[model samples]
Target: AGSSGSRGPSPLTIGMADTIPLAVAFHEIIHSYFRGTEESKCQVKMSGDMMLSFPTGIVGVLANNPNPAKLCFRLKNIHRLDNVLPNKQLISINTMMSTRDTTVVDFNMPALTALLRRQSEKNPTAQYFNVDILKYQIRPKAGAASCPFQLVAYWKCEQDHTDLKVDYKYNLHAMSPPSPLLNVSVCVPMNGEVKNVIAMPKNIWNGENEQALWRFTELSQHSDDRGVGSLRARFELDKGPSSKGTISAQFNCEGATLSGIEFELVGSGYRLSLVKRRFVSGKYICDSEVH
Candidate 1:
């Protein structure tokens, strides 16, 4: 839908939108069928790396894209408390985390195992799951904004108007990689407010032709019934002729000093690791092999 301030991109290709959803649908269905079993047929291809043969026993073309490239458009959690029956029915909250709720929705559940003895089931032709993201901060020690994860989900039941309990995890990666050498401190606030005060990564790349600046490539978080549970941070080189240097992040919270750090691709990744460990008293350590 177009709006007053900006026009949205054209609708997504039907095939592309259905790709990840299809995978997620199967995952959920397997979980339902297996119930208490630790091993389920769905586990056959748990990792996206393996090719899976469906009911037809035919394997579809598996894409070679990086695992990180898969779009996690929606994240949901099934809480035991809200079910219709005691220890019987399962209640799941469907969350859509996009700017606009997707109008078209469908669901399918097939009896993947003989133990269930159920045939394929599909939801109605259309449904909607709206998602809202709230930021919460993690205090240095304890504070009103103290939390580990960055994202939150809210849901209300139409029948009772009672607040529905929901949980979700956001796949958020820090734009910067966690440093092995430096101590990194992260503070989560209420409503996705983050006071990042971790020492910057020490640049290791010094080649004349390589880029050597530090920058976060990704940042995200997740929330659920128990509060924040997901955390991630990733950093990459910025454009510039290769050069090496030290960076620092510092912040204070509830009388505690919090810091998480990284040591970058300098000519001396080894030495940088040692210096970083000493820098944050072994706070957020980076991989020694990251040269």
Candidate 2:
């Protein structure tokens, strides 16, 4: 690391030497983040030789930019960028388009409807949902650094003929390593008198808030789309005090109702109110008050 008259390693020279390795590392990190439990062990490691082979290709892409200032701005704003130089900038539009076809041939008993009716009769407390990801696509547009992704989810509600669906499209500029999400699903008994009361299963009701009607404890935690993406939250009678009634629940994903179920309470009645909704940095909605 020889220095010029400045007596320090040249920032420009170090940026050049470090850029290739940094980009390689970033690519490998993306793969690891998407790997699920079944594919946990699968990841491609980049070697120094492999990185060197793409030196010119990487630099060419960076240098050909029409505006150098834009490059610096992009580098600075990168979520994963570092202090020294803009984090390794790797913009490759690898177009990947795949279709998935699934036809559920449910050939059992008289029909799906009849079978579900009989099952519901036997287990009245059970909640049934036939969920499906109706449509999904990752479309790569020409010359765009980020790729556009579309997702649609649908489900059939047997209790009521409610066709739940969610349609959303977004562009992915960069992908980060998969981080675990604190997913919790809990169904606490609703206090009949109080509109909203915080009740802990193991202890007494300590606090009360508009969003504290029903408490939720994390049954499990996982990352976004890492594996078994959607979480199942259910409310049953045995754990709660009420005998049975009905609770109106409207589950919405990105402004679209994915699933809505009105539980027919046999003995007691309960209700849920969504209080505070916070949008994270990436526009991911986090419901703080799901009572």
| Per-model tally of clashing residue pairs | 53, 11
User: What is the alpha-carbon lDDT for the whole of candidate 1?
Assistant: 0.19
lDDT of 2 by residue, 221-253 (tens): 232342223222222222233222221111111
Query: By TM-score, how accurate is candidate 1?
Result: 0.15
Model 1 residue 148 distance off true place after TM-score fit, in angstroms? 17
How close is every model to the real structure, measured as TM-score? 0.15, 0.20
**What range of 10 consecutive residues in model 1 has the weakest lDDT sum?**
23-32
- Which residue runs does candidate 2 get wrong by more than 4 Å? 1-15, 19-191, 194-200, 203-291
Give one digit per residue, the lDDT tens place, for model 1 in 1-291. 011233222122222113221111110000001111121211110000101112211001112222211111221211111111111121122234221222111111121221112211231221211111111111132211111122222222122121211122221221112211122232211111112212223332323422222322222231233223322222122331212111222211111111221112112101110111111111111111112
- For model 2, the local distance difference test gives 0.21
